[model samples]
Target: MTVNTRELSTIESTILAYFQALNDADIESILDLYSEDPVMLPFLQPAVVGANAVRANYESTFQLIRFEVQTTIQELVEMSPEWAYVRTDTSGIFTPIRTGEGAPAAFHELFLLRKMGNEHWQIARYSFSPAGALPPI
Candidate 1:
C-alpha cells in the first residue's frame, strides 16, 4: 500500500527533517530539533551534554567532514503520544573536506524523543555508533 505523507506522525516527520538538516549542515535547524536539555553520544566520543555542547560538536564535526548520507528509520516505537524512540541506520559517503576524500560511512542511531511545550517532537537523547561488527552477543 502507498503511504500518505499527510498521514505521517509528528515523530516521523521530525526524524526526516533531522536527517535533512544533517545533510544540509544547517546547525540552526539541527538545534531547533532538539530539546532544552539535549544529549548526544557520538561514535568513539564522550557524551555531549546541553545545547551549547551539541552545537560545538556539530560545528567541529562539520568542519572536518561532510556527510552525503541516507538515513533509514528501522523502527519507531511510540510509548505514548508524548514520548517515543526511533532506531535508524545511515549509510553513505563521508567526505573530509581537508583531504577531499570520501569514504564509506555507516552508523546505527537511536533517538529518544519527547513532545515539547509547543507540542512538537524533539530529540532529547541521541546516540550512534559504527554500524559494522561489534562484540558477539
Candidate 2:
C-alpha cells in the first residue's frame, strides 16, 4: 500500500535503523525496535517468530561467536507503508561454535520488513548469501 510522505519517512528511518543498530552492536536498542509478535527470516534456517524468539536466536548466535557480528547497509528500499527492504554488506569475525577466534567472513543480506501496530516496523522476511571470504579481523 502507498504511504504518505510523513509515514514514508518514518519507515525509511526504521529500515535504516536496522543497519545502524547492527553497526553499533547495541542489542538492547535493536530489541526495542521490534514488536512482540514480529517474525524473522534468517539465512538457511526455519523462520523465527515473535520478539522473544527473535531475541533468543540472536542471543544464541552471539554467544557462540568469539567476536561481534556487524553489518553495513549497502541499499534500502521502502516500497509501501507496510513493506520495506534493506540490502546490507557484512564483515565480521564469527564462531559457529565455541572455539578460540573464529574466522572472519563476508556476506550480504536482504531483509524485508513489515510495519505493525500503529508505528513500528519489524522484520518479516529475509535472504542471505555468502559473498566471499573477508580479510582477517
Candidate 3:
C-alpha cells in the first residue's frame, strides 16, 4: 500500500530513534518507547507480551549482534484519535557480538501504534515476513 503525503507524519523520525537506541545498546531507551503492556512478535520467536518480554528480546538480540534497523514506512492509516496502522520495510545489518561479522535481514511489517498522549507512540501489534517469493528475511 502507498501512503499519500497527507498521511505521512514525523512518526518515521520516532521509529528511526527506536532503531538508533538498539544499535547503541541502550535497551532502557528502547523500552521507554514502548507501551507498558505492548505485544511483540518477532520473526523467529513466539509472541512476547509486556515490556519485560520486549526488553528481553532486545537484550538477547544485542547479545547476538548489534542491530541497526533501517525502516521505510510505506503506509500510514489513521485508525482513531490515538491509533494508526503502519506498513514498513526494515533492513538491518546484525554485527555479531563475538566476531563482529554482519548478516543482513530485511523485514516487511504491519504495525499498529497507539498514541499515549505524551507525544509518544506505543506499538500494539507488529506482524511481518518477507515478500511472497522470498524466504523469511
Candidate 4:
C-alpha cells in the first residue's frame, strides 16, 4: 500500500504539538490535542481517563513543574484510514517551581491517534514508561 505523506505529516505534527504544549506549560493546548474521552497511562501512575481528568492531571503537574521535551518518533503505523499508532522516545528536563530542583527524564511512549473527521487528528490513548532500566530476563 502506498503511504500518504500528507496524512503521515498531520499525525506526526499532532504528536509534536502534544510535547510542545507540555514544554510551553499550556494546559489548554495540551487538552486540545486529546479527544473528548481519552486515556493517559503515565509512568508509575494510575491511569487517567477522560478529558477533564486528563486536564486536572496536567494542571497539577504544571503547577509544580515545567518540562522541556525532545521527542524522537521511533515508529508510526497506519492502522486504518482513520487510525494510527506512534511509538516515540522522549527525553526532557523538568524544573520545579518552588524548590528549583531540575532533573532529566526519559521515557518510551505509545500513542494512538484517531482522525475525528477529515481535517484533524487527536490522541485517543497514550501510554508511557521509563526508558533506561531493563527488565529481568
Candidate 5:
C-alpha cells in the first residue's frame, strides 16, 4: 500500500496530541484517541481492555498524580493499509496530588494505531514500560 505523506503527518500529530492530553490531565481527550475496544498494557499491571476499563485506569491515575510529559517519536511504520505502529521515548515528571511529592519518570511506549476511515487515526493497542536497562544487583 502506498503511504501518503499527509497520512503519516496526521499520525505523528495524533501521537503528540495523546501526550498533550495526558499532561493537561484531560482524560476525555486521551480516551478519544483510543478505539472503542482499545487495549492498554501498563507496566507491571494487568492488561486493561475496552473503553470502560481504560477509563477507570486513567481516572484512578489522574486522581493520584498530575503529569507533565515530553515525548520523542523514535519510530513510525505503516503496518498495513489500516494499521500503523509507533514507538516513542517519553520523559516527564509526576506530582502526587495527595502527598505533594514529585518525581521524574521515563518510559518507552508502543502504540498500534488504526485508521478509522480516511483520515482519522485512533490507537487500537498501547503498551508502555519504564525506560532503561535492568540494574545489576
Candidate 6:
C-alpha cells in the first residue's frame, strides 16, 4: 500500500500495486488485481487457469519465499481501449521463509490487463520467466 502514483497512469499504478502486493506477500491484494478469469504462466510450471487456480498458485508460492524485487517497466502498450500490456524486468532477492536463505532473483514479466466499461483495470493474463532460464516461480 506504500506504492507511489505521482505521474503514473491508472494501468501503471495498478501494476505497481501488484509489485507491492508481491513484496508484502498479500494474497488478497494480489488476487484483487486480477480479472474474473485470470491465467498465470509461471516459470517451469503448468499454466494456472481461472481465479481459483491462480489463488492456489500464489498461496503456495507465498508460503515458501518472500519476494523483494524492484520492477522496471520496459514497455506499456495500449493494444486497444479496454486492453493493454506491460512488460517489466524485476531484480532482487527472495528469502526462504523457513530457512531465511536469500537468493538473487531476476525475471521478465508480461502482464495483460483488461478493463470493462467504467471499471478499473485488472490482470487477465500474466507470464514470467527467470532471467537465468531455469527454476520455478
The candidate with the higher TM-score, 1 or 3, is 1
The regions of model 5 sitting more than 4 angstroms off are 132-137
Compute the lDDT for candidate 2. Answer: 0.67
Q: Which is the winner by TM-score between candidate 1 and candidate 2?
A: 1
lDDT of each: 0.85, 0.67, 0.71, 0.87, 0.88, 0.87
lDDT of 1 by residue, 24-54 (tens): 9899999999999999998888999999999
- lDDT per residue, candidate 5, 53-127, as tens digits? 999999998888788879999999887778999999998776778766667778899999998766488999999
Tell me the deviation in Å of residue 9 in model 1.
Answer: 2.1
Comparing candidate 1 with candidate 4, which one achieves the higher lDDT? 4
RMSD of 5: 3.5
- Residues 2-116, candidate 4: write the lDDT tens digits: 7988889989999999999889999999888998889999878999999889999988988887777799999998888889999999987767777676677778999999886
Number of the top TM-score candidate = 5
Model 3, range 1-137, lDDT digits (tens) per residue? 44444434645555667667867999888787676788887666799888778888877877776767677878877766677778888787756678776677777888787777756666677667744332222
Q: Which sections of candidate 1 miss by over 4 Å?
A: 1-8, 133-137
The TM-score obtained by model 2 is 0.66
The C-alpha stretches of model 2 lying farther than 4 A from their native spots are 1-16, 23-25, 66-72, 95-97, 116-120, 133-137
Give each model a TM-score: 0.87, 0.66, 0.77, 0.90, 0.91, 0.89
Identify the runs in model 4 with alpha carbons over 4 angstroms from their true place.
Answer: 132-137
Q: Write the per-residue lDDT of candidate 2 for residues 39-92, one digit (tens) a residue.
A: 777656898887788788767755654434567777767787667877888777
What C-alpha lDDT does candidate 5 achieve relative to the native structure? 0.88
Q: Evaluate model 3: give its TM-score.
A: 0.77
Candidate 4 accuracy as TM-score: 0.90
- For candidate 3, the 10 contiguous residues with the lowest summed lDDT are 128-137
Q: Which candidate comes out best when scored by lDDT?
A: 5
